[model samples]
Target: MDILAKERKLLELEKQVEALGNNEAVNKLKSEIEKYKHNEMTKLTAWDRVLLARHQKRPTALDFINYMSPDFIELHGDRLYSDDKSIVGGIGSINGVPFTIVAQQKGKDLENNLERNFAMPHPEGYRKALRLMEQAEKFKRPIITIIDTPGAYPGIGAEERGQGHAIAQNLLKMSEFSVPIISVVIGEGGSGGALALGVANKVLMLENAIYSILSPEGYASILWKDASLAPKAAEVMKLTAYDLEEFEIIDGIIKEPLGGAHYDKRETFKRTKQAIITEYNKLRRLSGTELQYRRTSKIRKFGFFQRFNYDNLGGIKR
Candidate 1:
């Protein structure tokens, strides 16, 4: 019931997703989670959801990459600007099969946070991501991305380099990419910073992670001119896992450890590896034509959805 604790909430959510024995009891819980019925998630606050995404104990992209794959070959620089530490990618082998992974890392400590820019990609960061993704295409290797950022750095320098265009380019590039691509939002997938690396044949998110256009504080600041009501805004935004999943924006959910990825790294990593491998196996078995169809078909089916436009003034245009 204490959903404020990311770890505990994640464990409960994991139990909901996994195969809990006693069919009758499981069915009861399942029914309760269903929105059509009395959903327990109705109690969540917007800021609470955002906090879960940025929880101190949440697993970082690096943590997952370090354990999930071995002997990673990291690449750097945008070839246009300085290298951005926020984004790291290169040739890596998962289960001994070579592939390229683009992982966006958030800071775990003050020093690390400074280096990673709090996982906020600058224009160069996005450019670097774009460069590596091109490499994946050249080698005919599948692309896997881990998204974890509060959002792109919206500073004068970043804007000068065309941050919007950089993100747009990535979206266009990934959509038409020739190789299999899967993106997983491990935590705090915010705005264009996250979307720059988010396009994929299939997208996944951990149970406690949140993916949204903006963080609750930013949303609150813009809408209410007050950053204190982020929790209220989070509920309004519906940035949680079940919310996005039900909307069909993401393809699947990667169940985390009992308390969350941070709670049990080994267990969480195992589950993550299984999900990645399962998707890889499914994609790898198909022929070029089949893969192409599968890829396009998966995208063409997405709902371009419309929502009530909520601007800062409490004015929602219908």
Candidate 2:
């Protein structure tokens, strides 16, 4: 069988083992499964990493919370319309460091994904995120945002409810917060939806995650009239963590497990937690105003280009 088929078989076996509860037989089977994982995930290309980022077995924000933070108390509601499940935020402690954690939740299965709108949050979600950030600021607790959205929901309901305004508001307000803000792009960080929660003193990306204005498929459809050219688009877009790290678009990278995060959840959680702690500790040393200035400075330094010298065009004849 192909690697894809083998992966599916392994996933099914894992579910069966889970359903049967733990046993010596199950433990042995689990060990056998682990042996196959490294082979299944061969050397990955950018497009392969994209596929892995969207893999159903991959851990999401809630998974990271459960593994990395204890005593998490989830807060709900935008207080205007209703609570948006796509964006999960609350108070939590990471190794006893109090923080307000906001995360984009892309559900585990099709039914749950539909329920969370595949993690494309609405206006209320952004509003809800801002509300939580303000609370974090009020309490002088640090803020950490996990960004994993395809983009802000562009549905009529979301637009009518001021989705653009809501995201814009978050960008403006989060910058003024008097507490440390660290944003992690754990998966698909797309456009303003990702940015709404990403105005942070430090921005981190998982090794396999992609952060960009839009998906490669979307980029291809708009520019090349064919979504199948997405592989080519992915290369040119420079959305991978490695690319972003070189461009200084992100503060640092949380290295994934050998095959990917899905291959080993515990290791990924450890790496992510360490990256957060290290970066946050550095930001914590700075005063609130200094944090804001550094964040603003870091953002402004991105994507600048020098004017072309037309006067020196076509190579001088000297």
Candidate 3:
């Protein structure tokens, strides 16, 4: 069985051990669980991490807010249109330091997933986020964004409402925002939907999270004409936290609990809280112009290239 299965079995065994009042069995199971958790972390492939990021039991943005922030007050609507529930934003305090929190919300079950549009946000969702961000900037509060989405909703209604324009506007505004912004990719960070909230001073990822321009399935379908080749596409895309961190695409990775974040919700929360606080403290030292320059410089450094000599130009005369 896989590590997740083993972990679940251990959890079940522990519960049964409590009922049986067997100390020896409980100690044995605890040791096995610890060993399994440690070993599983080293064995996970990029695709395995991707699956773990999307695990149904994984902690959500709201969960993080509850654990990391002492108090939170959710703000709603784009003001130009209706509220989009898929993206949630609010003002909250962590250790008495206030921040504007913005993040995507995936459903806990099928009914709620449909309600959240499977975390595929609409035009209004982006707009709502930008609005909150703007408010944060006005108050000089730092911005914290949590990304966990498949992509923007590709529905006809969303398109009609100008989805592309909304995302583009956010990219532009966030880049120019004068306050510090910290973004965390908590799960499936796909396409422009993810980028909308991801342009920040410090971009962090959960160790198991995946972030890419598109889903591996979409990439495989487009490039290889085979949706089943998604595993291959995932390997090639460099979407894992370790790969992205190596390339300096993300500022840092918040290490997940052994067996992935889903295996230890409170531990995940603690790690996330600590990572955010550490980064935010660093950013709080920079001036507004410094923050803007750092953000722009960081974004501009994404893709690597080499200068080619004129002699090496193939189609031109020497």
lDDT of each: 0.80, 0.89, 0.90
Q: Which stretches of candidate 1 lie over 4 Å from their true place?
A: 1-47, 287-318
lDDT of 3 by residue, 1-318 (tens): 544566677778667766766578677877776676567566887777778888998988899999998689999999998999999999999988999999999999999888888899999999999999999999999999999999999999999999999999999999998899999999999999999999999999999999999999899999999998887888999999999998899989998877788878999999999999999899999999999999988999889756556766565543
lDDT of 1 by residue, 1-318 (tens): 334553356457657656676677777776655542223333545455566667787878878888888788899999997999999988888998888999898888899999989988998988899899898888889999999988899999999999999999998788777788888898888988898888787788887789988778888899999998777778888898888889888878887654346667778778887898888887887665666676667667766667667686688766
Expressed as tens digits, the lDDT of each residue in 105-190 for candidate 2 is: 99898999999999999999999999999999988999999999989999999999999999999999987887899999988899
- How far off is residue 32 in model 2, in Å? 15
Candidate 2 residue-wise lDDT at 257: 80
Tell me which of candidates 2 and 3 scores higher on lDDT: 3
> Deviation in angstroms for 47 in model 3?
0.8
Per candidate, the number of residue pairs that clash is 5, 0, 0
Candidate 2 error regions (>4 Å): 1-42, 306-318
TM-score of 1: 0.80
- Cα lDDT over the full model 3: 0.90
Clash pairs, model 2 backbone: none
